[model samples]
Target chain A: MKYVITLLVGMVTGAVAFVLLLYYNPFVGNQSVSPLAVSELDLVDFSYSLLASDSIVFTNDGESHMQPHPAKVLQLWEPTVKMTRALVTILNDSRGQPAGLGVKFSSDSEKTRLINAEVVVDSVWHIYSPEHGTFFVDQTENFWPYLHDIVVPARLSGGDSWRGSWYGITSTGPGALGIARVTGGAGDFADTEGEAVESIAARAYSAITGPVAMTGKLTIALPRQEALP
Target chain B: MLKIFYLGIVMGIAAAAALVYIYPVVDQHREPSLITVRPNGGNSESFHIRLPGDRIMAGVTGSTELTPLALEWPEHDFLANMQTELFKVRNENDVVIGAASRMSGWSEQHGSFVEWVVHLPARGSMFMTMAAKPSADGYREGKLRAGTREFLTLNGTVIERFVNEADDSDSDNVGRIELVTALVGLPDELE
Candidate 1:
């Protein structure tokens, strides 16, 4: 009987101790190493090509050569733009995480709009343009969504390719009695749709270190909008 | 005594389990943290922290208050291209610490703004503010400002300051305006 009684007491004591341990939160302590620190090395190289199209409307005034005209004609203007870039590098920071990106372009070529643009990604992504200084790309911003979709996935290896489409509206010129004209009317506008395609292939030399290469193409074609007769 | 031993063993197991869970939480809470920048007019998404062994810890708590320091937008045809706004956070040495960007709308609206709060270890804290302005001539400009009140020990005390400006033309003929500022001092470790 004594033995059973002692056993019961011990069980009760142990249960109470367990409850206390949970309540006091004894597990709270410091970590020997920071989990946030990244220690791996990942090197990536990529190329991008783009072809896009937009629909534009142009106004044609047969009589007015330079001065303003009250009434004018309407015409459609379609402009196509093609851009390509090669040998972009993604570099890691001291923490072994993706910290910066550098893109090299041919300075002599006018087609290279972004020349030597360096982007640093720490708390925020900073795209540094020699002509524009630094620009921030956040999730709330327009540029972030497009670049994020392309750059984030392209950093990894194996089947890294993506395609998408976007649409926008543009207007030009002054108000001419609320007339629907392009470049000279009160409401001259162009509705544009753009498509982009990207393909990236990566080769990992080692478990912690490797090289990744990507090639992308974007084509933008502007279509003409006919006037209503 | 044998029953007591068994009870102790069970209690030890429970204690170990509890410690394992609490250790990480305590460690994370004490470390410098940051939150994910929420999309404009969208729900808040979880912030991710990369862990060892291909593990990731999501939904970590950190600051999301990004403040603008300066802004400059050149006059141009606004309707020709989509308007853009960019925000950057930098230390006193003019080193960029954080940044964010978004599309500016073509409307005469007021009070449209976004902010980010950054904490620098042993240096100080700062908040960046980027406010959208009314579109003029189809060109949209943003106002930038910075403050240290969120983590400032004293109100109105000058801790650090920065300025950022970006002005360039893109292929689309869109005149770009930039803001660059060194808003906070570097941490003691960095210095």
Candidate 2:
């Protein structure tokens, strides 16, 4: 009886093991499908420059399959798109009149509050309105360049307010793309000293106010006249 | 002795199950465009119409939940534009999953806007793309004499009005704003 019981147990165990192996990885014996080829995905980079000055950058890695119609190699598996926005805003005067705005597209994603901008042309001089507060933008330099600089200019307007809007310039291409936007920092010059830029910049000055939100669009296809061949 | 043999069998089955994996080359979706904006007028910054709820399509690794981003400057049409076109590859249910993304001119890590939480089974895979930001295109808002040369401030950012394919003033038209990804994320495994 003991021998029979031991034989029965052994047979049951062997059966279970066989079933598990067969069902779990039926292809284990074949070895025809290369593990590397099965899961292997190729990575490719892509970029597109819009008719406008804006540009896009991206990366993608997907299946190298053939298109149904064209039969062309379509990386159907991997797809990516990037857009860049040049942040700018328009304000209103007492007559409820509208005025011109400015924008600078700083690529670096680092740096929290500020972005370094190049004046593409000599149009107008800009300043931070105390009432409207300070606008946040990605710094041209590394992240947190002004880790401790929070001194508002001595001459700051108080109680006064201004209005404005933001814009984004995005673009894309075959594989990858890029999008740009002005760094809209969390808040005005974060007083490394404190959150009292109002008091510091105000300095018993006149009235100042905070800036308001505005709108714009992402111009992808630019006219040939406005674009470089 | 019999019990020991049974245990070994059980262990072998478990081990085989653990080794199971499928490299699914999912050509599930195409283009992966979640947003599109049509220009109505020649050059106008007007919120004339909308597409309701202003929803956006997101695709992540496998199937994972996502969160709505609270941008510092929400009011600007930026959110609107992002909503419709914030295209990200996702699972059937629509989750922004990311394990590996191959995008040029950019590098990305999980948990950027939404809380980053995702994992892959042993041989699982994930693929995604990050869209580039605007302004980096080099189109200057005309030019600036001084101050922060970026977004809205006291004076505001401006660029010279150019022309588009229509030869009309190159008004604000988001040519293409998208982000896509797809892959097998772990099945409810620790994120």
Candidate 3:
């Protein structure tokens, strides 16, 4: 009888622990030794040429499974912006599980999101092909390898007076980033996305139930940072 | 007694699960960061720099915030051509500081062009404000002519830097304005 009680107590304790684990969370574990040999990128086949027409590329030497910071330049002259950049981040769930990123673009200018692709944790990606206005990349999580020519329209041209908004997320909808552009380069960053390549905006982790809509910073200009005194 | 203990254990497990779920929310925090990108108003975009990166802040070019300027347009559209700098936020002698740009609209939709995205170490920022007096020149198509300088040109916002050997006085900080390319101007559609 004592053994039975002890076993019962132990089972309950484990169950309690599991419940708590599912509720509260801790700091997502730090980025492990990225398997990509982050330093070897200089020697690898990764090159700027990776970017094709209407696109740019940022090659990184990180863990094969890690999403790295794409090449990017944050600041530019307001009058004549010549380039653009992308902010890349790897989102991990409470259990430190990567919840893939869903990428999308919208010239519709009607809503804020233009979701077009999904970068699953399995290193697979899905991108919307303008040819059919449909999402592809059914096999890979990383689009960096096979993104083809696409029109990255400028955010605001004197001709269109348009505002292009792009957003990314995972299947669970936990991790996301919204990108906006004003002018030049169609702004379709396929390869290199930003200068001084690093995290541009804040990282948004999804809510527990699922990836809830994020209420993070929308624009990188004057991103509430200490850049300007 | 044994049954009581099991119920208590289950209760404890449930409580713990509840705690775990509420943790991330109670500790809601996000690092204030930004990925500087060229605004493309499109989905596929690119960023040149990550402003507020660790280094830019450490390597202070003596940044300054200039008074924002307001731009005026005509009653009827011309070709979004209007350029007239209002005031100069000077730090010219100050080499490599930061620049900020933001524009406001009165009646029409807020002009997205007013926001300064230039990464130039501004030595000066123009806090401009004025109302445009549009005449019957009527709106032009391609480019605005000098007769009606109403066309917005490259009214570059200048940020003065410390001259090679200029007096390094606090006032020595000065930047010049070289109206680069007003990407989104008083739209050509709007005269």
Candidate 4:
């Protein structure tokens, strides 16, 4: 009778313990909620510049793809479409410090005389170091020069806190000038609307030797955070 | 008193260990199901994905689920449904080849701008920029603008289709995306 009672007690104690363990399981709770709050900056106004050599122009004019066009602005006879992708430096009041990375892809068509530009910016400058090159903020790897591999992963891994996308529109001409607006964004620039004016410097377009000097001012209006009750 | 305390501790420890061992086995059965990629043949492949919940959509950068963002201007008469999404790309064999970004938007000034950037690691990346509008059947067709490396000189057209209304309650199926790529330019060896 004592053995039976002891066995019952053990079984009951074990079942209660198991239920408690299940109730407080560490892995079962909600992990999707981000710990970081959105930035409080109401308006972010910044300027950015892209050097000519930093941009690559891929044309469908049947020209040799290997031919070097470092300036990125190409002159073609046929009604061709050119896809240009550039890595630009985001600046603050023309100052280099606290600068960040910008990746812009523009598709220009001579046939339609239209240009569509998609720009992705990481304003905090998470993974890019001008002197030591590109390295992870966590210091996992050595200085890697490839911005293509670094930018996407940095954006994906949530290391890029100040990130957004601004879609721009421009027309094709001898000396082209265009404007852009905030189409969509994430992070600090979420629910934001702003305007930016982009223009190619006269010298960059006229001379093939000079780099494509692009200057633009971006004014983004961040949404106000709701007050907690 | 000491014996009872020791016995309770021992039972608690044993029960915790047993629960840890059994939890995974039970939890595996409760996880959401996933479907395989179904091929439509002739250069077209279709993918089935779950419709992510609102929590996943609101948190853009870090959410584990694939989130599509509305990228349209509110005031403009631009098509109401401008969106952009980035997700993993799989080949016909359903092996994850790389990642691709898709942006679909339309404006009265620009007409329709649908672009896909497919980045294949080590091999190269392809940019397919289509000016064409979606058909009545809801599929958009566009020409390949440019490529790098292996796809450098290839000319192709991609047909994209988003099929079926997602039945969120259905475990077997949720949604589907179909992509058909027809290439025109290839080297003699590849041809």
- Top candidate when judged by TM-score against the true structure: 4
How far is each candidate from the true structure, as Cα RMSD in Å?
Answer: 24.9, 25.5, 21.5, 23.4
C-alpha displacement of A167 in model 4, angstroms? 27
Residue B160 alpha-carbon offset, candidate 4, angstroms: 0.4
- What is the C-alpha lDDT profile of model 4 across A1-229, one tens digit per residue? 6655665576567667665554444443221221112335344444554443332221112342223223222222221111222222333444534333333333221122001111211111111212111111100111111111223333445434212322222211111122223322222222233333232211121122222334443333334444211
Query: TM-score of the candidate numbered 1?
Result: 0.22
Total backbone clashes of candidate 4, pairs 3 or more residues apart or in separate chains: 1
Query: DockQ of each model against the real complex?
Result: 0.04, 0.04, 0.04, 0.03
Candidate 4 residues B71-111, lDDT tens each? 11112122133444444444554444444455554434334
Query: Which residue window of length 10 is worst by lDDT in model 4 chain B?
Result: B25-34
Candidate No. with top lDDT: 4
State in Å the error of residue A132, model 1. Answer: 31
Would candidate 4 be rated incorrect, acceptable, medium or high by CAPRI criteria? incorrect
Tell me candidate 1's TM-score on chain B.
0.28
| lDDT against the true structure, each candidate | 0.25, 0.22, 0.22, 0.36
| DockQ score, prediction 2 | 0.04
Interface RMSD of each: 23.1, 18.2, 17.7, 21.2
- Give the worst 10-residue stretch by lDDT in candidate 1 chain A: A76-85
For candidate 1, lDDT tens digit of each residue in A113-224? 1111212111112222221122222110012222333444444535444333322111100112111111100011111211111222222111121122222221111122
TM-score between candidate 2 and the true structure: 0.18
